[model samples]
Target: MKRVIRILISYALALVLVIVSMNCSFVNIKADEQVYLSVSKSNSWESEGKYYAQFNLTITNNSSKNLQDWTINISKSGGEISQSWCCFVSDLGNSYELKPESYNKEIKAGENISNVGLIMSFPAETSNINASISPVFETEVKESPNIKEEDSNKEETKSQESVEVTEEINAGDEVETEEIDENLANAALVASRCFLSYADAPVIAIRACYDYMIVLNTEPKEEQETIAEAAVTAAQTASEFATDGDVESINTANNANDDNNAYEVSKDNEPVIEDSNPEAVEDNEPVTSVAGNKNIPTGRLRVSGTKLVDASGNVVQLRGVSSHGLSWFPEYVNESAMASLKADFGINVFRIAMYPREYAGYLTGGDKETLKAKIDEGVRAAANQGLYVIIDWHVLNYNPNEIKDEAISFFNEMSMKYAGYDNVIYEICNEPVGADWASQIKPYAESVIATIRANDPNALVIVGTNTWSQDVDAVVGNEIDDANVCYSLHFYAATHKDNIQNKLRYAINNGVPVFVSECSICDASGNGGIDYASANSWLELLNSLDVSYIAWSLCNKAETSALINSSCSKTSGWSEEDYSDAGKWFMQAIKNQ
Candidate 1:
């Protein structure tokens, strides 16, 4: 009888503790504004007696965390959406759920999207919706991976600095360390709430903790890390608990908490959604791109005073790789492969080499239409990945006059197809060797130029110079009279030393704009040894000039120029082990930043 009574008492206490612990998460919810949603009637004229109008929805995400499967549910006088643009809207009786489109799907931190417009019909001027409306959003429920090792190293450095400051405070120095430490701690506390995964916690919390702990000058190193780790853990746990709440509610027959339940990230990184029932995303919801630091925004490019200027009138230099003949190596033109180049290798542009005269090239090949379609697909992929694209007409030994008509047709099709896209660049001729810039190549370029300009007048066009694009000096006096025009400069580091760079300098000093369309740190044969000394010299020169350039051949060929191994087959997400010597060098150069 005594043993039974003791077991019952212990069981009762355990249940009470569990209830209190769970309740603490729910009651201690921190709320701030990291995301905001607003809706307004942009253009609306009633279509029928039932009433109809156009509404513009805007979302602003200010946090660094990447969110997916986001939803925006609104009830405005029980309205039904008929058509939507820039987003997929599913009508749910009186409310609606909105998902992002490809272009605006993954809203990067500090980005605002105001293009989501909808045509909906409802009673004219609903009271609460039209008068005053507020919206709420949910962060990603899935746990992100651990922080990168590099990021941890950075945190460890900051933590050490804080310890030094605390030592000063202990020696009768001002409480400066404490103030600095508290500020950082506050920031980290907020970061913890924003990025729930361990990967992101240090991205926010570590540095902050270092600052705060320095003020607590007396605290040991281990103690500082412990305190920071605890704060991050609390925030992460809160997010997981909230997601559970959302999921639990979804499985129920009636979601009674749907209307009143919403979560937000506060200025101090606090959790808003703490309920165990999550709003589950459907299996078919369009997934957003992973948040990456490689995405670059190259606004409209143009030729301005012997340099390439972006839309904001700032001179821009594009660094990237060109493919080694599209038909021969189409495997590397995939989204995943190109993404690795951008994210890991730091390439801003990808040059598509369209050989018009190979054994099975575009013109005489059986895959005529298929080749064109593949080129089109590559351009679309570039745009989707936020990368600039170059459509190179790889003309080596063939005379431009022989295929003038075909070239005209091809440029017309491509220019019209990729019109208005800031990422598209036209490389009219890859190499003009058999003719002079003024007489032979110049005339051929005029015709093709006229064709492309007819379709895309504002696109950046790169014309090949004579002597296989080494004779840029010839284009000094006889420059194209079109807007956004630049001359191509190709070089082989081991073969064409400062001799070629002399001509490059002469052209730039004069009134000629140049773009290094193709280059490699090897001999011209594409299968020679790499010359690092010469390559470093060239790098120094380009950086001084702020010149835009693309490396030679992003293929798996057994050569010095190829970035990857010949046997390795990967489209994207490549590890460092997958790269060759040349590829490794490029990665280091970019990361040297």
Candidate 2:
């Protein structure tokens, strides 16, 4: 009886030991949980209008458990909520009340889930937004399959089955996901607000519609179609909200889009709207005194037009000293010096020659700030003296095309900054040469001119000919398309320059306005390098031909042709008494004009 009892006890002890060993074999796999979210705007604030904000959410799981049910909540402080949508996910099972659109995914252990879409719209005025999401939950964690050492080979088969199930669920979720373009939403908003009333309603509506069309054309084909449909719907809605003026505007807009035949019909039926009283129209037009007129020539230097006309409608003669170096040294062009030029020398215009690249160099390196300040000071000084300032693009080397993009940016900034000012004239290119005149220079010049016109349509733009601006023939050949364009040429008759007679005759006979934009003479032979006597002869001829001329250099001390010496003093050779020869000559030319 004692032996049997001991056997029973031993069996009980063995059972207890087996249970302990099984518990020790069970593994607890820790999950690596993480969440990621990001925010972005479709367009930056620098753009013209409001833009949309987009948010993205991603979840990652790194455990043996399958995460199922989850919730995400997004919040914002500013801006009204416009609309919201989410992607579809299918891991939570039918028991969970998870919204199909918001369900991210059932992330298996060591698997990652991602979703990108509009969580919500924080309207145009919102400045800040915040978002948060809850951790994923599962109905229950399944226990590992019971297997002995002999069943270890089945582990790979079980893993494959889990993967296939997860993939099938993800595939189902993907079908319901939708994407929306933020740009189209912004466009719809703009269209809705564009039209309000009738006196001016039609014109306003047409402009708004045209703007919308431009935006649509720039978008991708699919997006463009979407935007077009939205725009059309918005336009119809706007018509309903509009007053009687609004209806008229809509009709006008529709008429503008009509065929050419319709346009002709409208034109034919339209009554003449001319004023019977010329006095009424004259009252509306701007009037300027003949003496106060300082109209910057609208066309190129070579074109014959009334842009720089005197009171009699003849070509106006502009005699001046080329103060290109003054731009480099603003301190020299003080009130005293400008006073000297105006009161004593009678200089009418100042050609401020600027080396395109070198002048731009002042904006780089440590001298950037200083250079900008100096340039501004110089511009102001010239303006204060009531002088016409020629912003010359002095290109000794480097094709204009090489820096065309930079030039456009520079010119746009300049044109807009001084659009209404009549004192400034933009010289698009300087001294173009070689084949670049046709290939690089002309195109670059045209581009810069267009840029300026886009901002200030009336700004005077001067374009130079090739070969150091000595090729008047080239200037006549490749004419600019713009009526306001002007051609420029440089002259140094002392270097066996082109005959003044030939140049003047060609310019006058061909109806091209010629300005010897730059000239220097040192001797009567016309080949002794910037000779004063030779320059005087050319000047007299230019005066007789009703031509304009700007002396080459106001700040070179070189004997060849020094108007103002290195010390900013008048050259002794011209006039010792008061440095009045150049000044007297300039005054006479102004009087004649």
Candidate 3:
């Protein structure tokens, strides 16, 4: 077994402190080597003469020995990196140096330390990437060895010998050790924001490598005073290089170990540094805040070739559930709850069903300002959590034409407010029951959609169809020519199965963009026993076609579609014990997915 250890060099006087084995061409785990390095592309895309790729770097320990330290050289032939996360990276002339900080120095064999994601941008001329790792060693620092000045005579002799050995195993890279004696006493910034985000880290861990090793302990009580001070000082020096107002330069790496951070990724557009490393950037700072949200789309979404594609031109599918009318159960419109749905409940998007005509709805007796505020809150929370949010103008029982002025004004307000947010999707009409497609509903859609376009032109818009949004084929016949516009189609598993589904197939094949804005497992009445099997069938169909969907509702209204039971009062953190039968099924489905 073998492993590739990335040993970062600091310029100062010291001796080599490690031993390892090397192989011709590349180092692989076997003999004295115990660690190996490998990388794979998690996502890739290109736009505007630039290519973007997210690569995951994996370091596997395949031997019985405990590996001590390592270093790797990664460079693109004709490109430069925008930034990286999960570790500190220093730009080294032609290549970037990947090194583990104090907290990530140890490797217990067979256990993998993953979640090292790199975001790179390169010119169109660059078409290839190169990566390789150097020497590895088997060792663990059970305790620090004494090297008092009184033993300098012996230490100097050993140090000289160690330095000679380091040069032999270092391959082509130079290895040096600098004794960091500076104090971080006056440094007000976060020392190691990168270290703070380690999995299961509060104090975190750091390992010292090279010829003269200095092991830094995570336990502050151990009181390795000089090493601790050096770790903080070393981190401070690295963070000084953080570029101002550069979102691509800051680190927003969120891993399982950073639960102690207890905050959401920033979605604010104003320039503020989120953090150079894993530390929380002050609110409103332009910082790279990667919150481990793998579901968040990295690029703008649009319809192309009869399917939804992200900015990278890769067909993408989204799956999530919508909230019931925001008139009730407004408690879930905060950051924690929305984050809970994504982190704990496994949802990629949350739809805000803003009813314009219900009892407590916006257009009715409901205070328009209050309703709008709640909608704003929901969108912001979803944004902060790095989840997609759909702002729906729910029009049921009455045509959107009846509330034409109100709908236009509302959409214009929302679109303008969330104009810059890619997570914000606009659903102009929820259900245009019994309206004519090309004459009545189309004109109303034209008015509202035009209003939204006037504010946020690039955002994805979903228009409702006539007769409960089941007429997707109608949209295909007279489709909107806009670039990112999609038609809404809703379904109740127990009610409209094959008929509407068949129409959907025809519409999709004919090139109409469809987004299922609402769905339920029961009849249209929103109550009674669930048709889970039918719902599963619907899900399969949606998945097969790369169609995105929002399951109908996140309320406790005692309905088969309501995810929470009537007896449950908590807005977030609802477990299986708190779910209705339908809720249980949906939760199970999300987990399965």
| Maximum-lDDT candidate | 3
Cα error of candidate 3 at position 544, Å:
0.4
The 0-to-1 C-alpha lDDT of every candidate, in the order given, reads: 0.58, 0.43, 0.59
**lDDT score for residue 295 of model 1:** 23
Question: How big is the positional error of residue 518 in model 1, measured in Å on the Cα after superposition?
Answer: 0.3
Residues 274-334 of candidate 2: C-alpha lDDT, one tens digit per residue: 2122122121121111122234343223234623653344555666766543223333333
TM-score per prediction, in order, is 0.51, 0.44, 0.51
Q: Evaluate model 3: give its TM-score.
A: 0.51
Instruction: Give one clash count per candidate, in the order shown.
Output: 25, 23, 32
Candidate 1: deviation at residue 218, Å?
87
Q: Per-residue alpha-carbon lDDT of model 3 for 98-135, expressed as tens digits? A: 77544445465675454354657776533335766543
Q: Which candidate order results from sorting by lDDT in descending order? A: 3, 1, 2
Candidate 2 Cα lDDT to native: 0.43
Name the lDDT of candidate 1.
Answer: 0.58
